[model samples]
Target: MVQRLPLDAFFQRETTHPHKRYMVQPQVGGQIEELSWAQVGNQARRAAAWLRAQELEPGSRIAIISKNCAHWIIADLAIWMAGHVSVPLYPNLTAESVRQILEHSESVLAFIGKLDDWPAMSGGVPEGVPTVGLPLRPAGRFDSLWSDLQAFEPISDNPQPAADQLATIIYTSGTTGMPKGVMHTFANFGYTGSQAVELFDVGADDRVLSYLPLCHVAERMFVQMVSIYAGQSIFFAESLDTFVHDIRRARPTVFFGVPRIWGKFQMGVFSKMPPKKLDRLLKIPFLGRVMARKVLAGLGLDAVRYAMSGGAPVPDALVDWYQRLGLEILEVYGMTENCGYSHVGRPGSRKSGWIGQSNPGVDVRISEQGEVQVRSGSVTQGYYKQPQLTAETITEDGFLCTGDKGEQDGDGYLRLTGRIKEIFKTSKGKYVAPAPIENRLAAHSEIEQVCVVGDGLPQPIALCVLSEAGRKELRESLQGSLVELLERINDSLDKHERLRALIVIDDVWAVENGFLTPTLKIKRAVIEGVYGPRFHEWMEYGTLVHWHDEI
Candidate 1:
């Protein structure tokens, strides 16, 4: 099979379906702007012509700093059309951090688009690098604006880059130290996109929301690349305030979210109908079936044929809850190194808690060190300017040593144990993997986020943040619920792995707070740093549940 670049697939789709709507962007006051395949191609062509006029060195790095907007995709396509590599920065990144990436990548140009926190990130672009302001960019000075570029005609010569040519440099969310730029070729995106579309059986009829940070590999491969490959339509969420409206307006045929989102969706259902009342209704014969449809429709997920949960391990209870509601969410597992093409819980052959079978053309084997190593359709070309770290990640034989530890059952389904570096030793010299334990705690529905830590302590303890549902409950009731959850989880764990207490805190964990990565995965080290000093103080309370405020 010929490995096609993203633009190749997109160009073909544009030619075949010129009138098909490709992007639906939400605007102010419940308005929306829809762009067709030909319309998008025309705009990208105009932008590409402007880029070519600059006469930069071939394969020059062109950066895009924006949220998920139609212009973001257009800018990326224009970069590809101009025969340059693309660099995408998370919209939530600090200005200094942005400067670090733009300078390190040596970005020659940047397209500034819709941003919620533009003031915070505007200072990151170095003075020398030319900036092009898109239609939605918060007021800023730029070398050129999207409106000005509109005067240029579409470039006549269509450019198709080679499959092996460098296509993008996606930086890590930096849960640890400085971010590392992950270099990937056009071939990587093409192959991963093709594999995912085939696995999900996605067609032109399918639609998807592009809410997750497009800079992340999972969203890049699944939303942008998959859409181009499958000729699927894309929708952009305006903001947190309009997320529900956006989802309902799109009514996407496919949906993806992290574990936290799935739990929130469950809670969203509960906000309208109490859990007990809904359960009672679901138990009824014909009424139960109608109720399930109503519940899913209300959440704007009634049309979702393929629902996926990833970026973290999901609890069996959470998955089962959705399953009971007739929404079977498949668990997908991958990382930045592989273009997010590792494993997906295939529809018919899924088992509880498993990451599912290895994707087609992907090889998965457990190393002697117990790390889950994978060689797939789209592994990275190594870290840009960080060869030493790249050498440490990819094995001499070829498999990417995915820092995660896992065990495969007899049927070939894989279950993650924890991060290789996350297994912390207690003061008693016992090792504990926090992921599995956190999954159990998060299953209670009230416990929104949890990080299990015990380094230098006799027993492992959990630091938790409450969900919207949890915060609404009466203090005594919430504490009692947590105690019950703690006892149940402890009963199933080994002595060293058992959590000593559930520390409930008032603080919310978000991407801006440094508690979570841009993709919503917890930053374990960051959490440990902020709370490590008080681990002993909280542990001294000697209670199964410790409310930080009341104490």
Candidate 2:
């Protein structure tokens, strides 16, 4: 089990299995287009030649803005091959934000591909920056189309980046203020990538589905770096409409999802098989196994050898529900600074809300202030151009301060209490950690998204958006079942942490609306800004499941 670096994997695969299918991309309709390892490598080589032909200085920064696509990855490979740094912007970012990131990153060239918001993106490019569009056409004029570079021969001696050289400058999707770029070197990726393959026993036989925003470290690690490291074939989902079909076609051996996506899968399952029927069926011993298998197969998760959820807390109840179906959703904890490799629950472990033990070669410690800190080979060098902030984040002892408050059990499993900034004191003078309570409330089949806020109030109250099933269930009982659900949740919490009422918000929280980050973590400050003033009013209503219209 030799651990190969990402670039080594690419060249090795290219020479070993030139014609082997490496990537399968969904086209318009049900069709899929496959690319061999050689073809992918060749395209990357040609693109690299084109990039170098521009004569930008070595280590110049380049930008990539696109949805998940094969071409997006090709451009990334090309960027590295050309000895340049890649700056990936979320496809859904506002034009103003895009401009700000590009300007701040000092990117000399940008590649645009597979975008839904072309006009906004096209307008966002800095006026003098050179732009090249991928297969997808840009809204404005570009210096070159991605296809034009295919005819060029690759550079005879493409520089292989050194381990210490900067590989990328990834900008965090800031919930509080301006996003800061996190600088990572090739050594960081090499360390984390090899560690993941070794820890998970990932091999070439494993298959993966790439659907999340690859700009994020999690998706980049599992979908790109891990795939490259293990020589595994990859699949890209076309759009949200075709996600299920794509998953079925890919039949990924390993799947990673945020809590929101997992909740939706639950909702989808319950839609066809009503909860009453599902509960009754599960009561039977042998039939329960058969039914669970069928349900998992129907959802395209039956083939999943490993399933993971991260970026937020997943409720224990939700994990238990999946375990009953014979699929254990392991909880993972990491950040962009750590290359998305930190703590991970072992497969078939107990259903604890804890995120699990530290990875091999990663050290985790709780600071005296109760913040989670780490010292690892995979940790980033520092934030780009933010030395003061970087000094604040990395302690004098050489550990990266995670800014998350957590406690480690005797067994070394870490249970996160809350973010330092997010802990709020109620009027009763008791501090409440909102994440645990909010995670518990979100476990209800009806609630899709939730945020808990009670600053200066008697008790914390929840603002939740209903899932489709939640909406359907709400239509039937009005508020009875929801009230019952809240009672159960409240019973499990400490007196001060109990949610007083669950207010139903009609609107969906999305990245476009600034309620969610691109990676699906809630923008708490943004959520609080819009809903904070009304919190006292909802708390005073003195009822459960307060409907927006009824208020």
Candidate 3:
């Protein structure tokens, strides 16, 4: 049976653990800061007392908008310690998006963190709502997190919250429309965290370096919860620009990344030493081991005992490449509704194109139409304030409709084919699942990003963006590489499903451009609409070489 504990109970248990290490920050200024479990507990207590002094009601929503910092964790725990629900906003979100979340969540208080410009972003907070700024460097405008804690007396009494009470309200990226808050109970998070630690064998001795947005469910559940549950040290990367350097400095035992970041890491490896040279080097006996170790070390992944990829589909070729380097990039499948972990590729049993078997205590099955459904202890009760969506997403039978089309192998491993909503019909009247084909094409080292579109066209065509190193390595002209890649990709598909043409996009799609979610999953519909008119030109011309190549 699963044991349910409040979020604070983990912190309390860790405070007594011999191996407890809390709030490790890798600084860009070539320094490292480490905090002990006792210290973390004290800080949280002080913050909780301050929050109580504010006269906020229990279960009131408090918002946090910032990158992944040590203070972000502190603020999160403080909110829970004060008997409130924590609402996290993506740090890089636009002002409009921020306003939408703040209004929708009905946040009574907000803690803003280090941003490019405070004056501009502050406008997003609703009028009459109390906002506190969290500055990395000492700023005179707002109360410093440390100062606020120091001013308050430690609250010795533990905050009483039921296991089934709401603990967090994490808003989804809203790729389809307005983001909805996914409410998770204390039991939901506690069970998910403990299960993950047990499944992965994470322990007090492990160390995790978290660089992904903590606002996302994947990082919050895996990185933060695992650390708190296992009594392990939690390290924060200084910034995205210095993530590689921070990783090398921290030498964490566990690492997590989105598909895009994993792809970039693989591209960096191939760029440093071309495949031909790497293959030749690996052929040597003793030197091969030394060179491979050096290569992995240089990539800041040498100490990684386990690496996971989630939030999007990872190309199989990338997984194979990492496997060759003595690293297994385990693919995970889950969503905010499931508390972030449902299926995980087991260590030493990974298969290409599969997200692995269902996790312990999670029941998974496929419907007649291939939609993946799951019933798990960690599944959320429902979406916050969205009863209609909740009714549509979760069935009366208690199984959550994952909205993803997938197939299960005889061994019970799940391989996702595509999102049910993303499947489109071709002019030939055949429904095409674009994700499988896109994943196959993206597996090629030359392709960095790809989107398949054919809603009303004769056939589907792929819009591809090549990696910088891939462009340089291919040696051929842009048009030549596109044709070669198209031929290579077509070899793996049926005649009707094969890509009809290739359109090379010079510019990379990113979150800032509204092409990707915060978790780095491509917003396919947005991309299709942005490039829809150009499809005709590309299909007629058969090639586009320029940076702004349309079609």
Report lDDT (CA) for all predictions.
Answer: 0.89, 0.87, 0.81
lDDT of 1 by residue, 267-369 (tens): 8888888888998999999999999998889889999999998899988888888887889899999888899889889886778777898888998899888
Give me candidate 2's TM-score against the actual structure.
0.97
lDDT, candidate 2, 205-303, per-residue tens: 889999999999999998899888887899999899888988998888999999889989988999998877997897799999999998899889998
- Candidate 3: C-alpha RMSD to true structure equals 2.2
- The segments of candidate 1 whose C-alpha lies over 4 angstroms from its true place after superposition are none
**Cα error of candidate 2 at position 18, Å:** 1.7
Clashes of each: 0, 0, 1
Q: Would you give me the overall lDDT of model 1?
A: 0.89
Question: Residue 152 CA error for candidate 2 (Å)?
Answer: 1.0
Which scores greater on lDDT, model 1 or model 3? 1
The best candidate by lDDT is: 1
- Sorted by TM-score, highest first, which candidate order results? 1, 2, 3
What are the per-model C-alpha RMSD values against the true structure?
Answer: 1.1, 1.7, 2.2
The TM-score, computed over Cα atoms with residue i paired to residue i, of candidate 1 is: 0.98
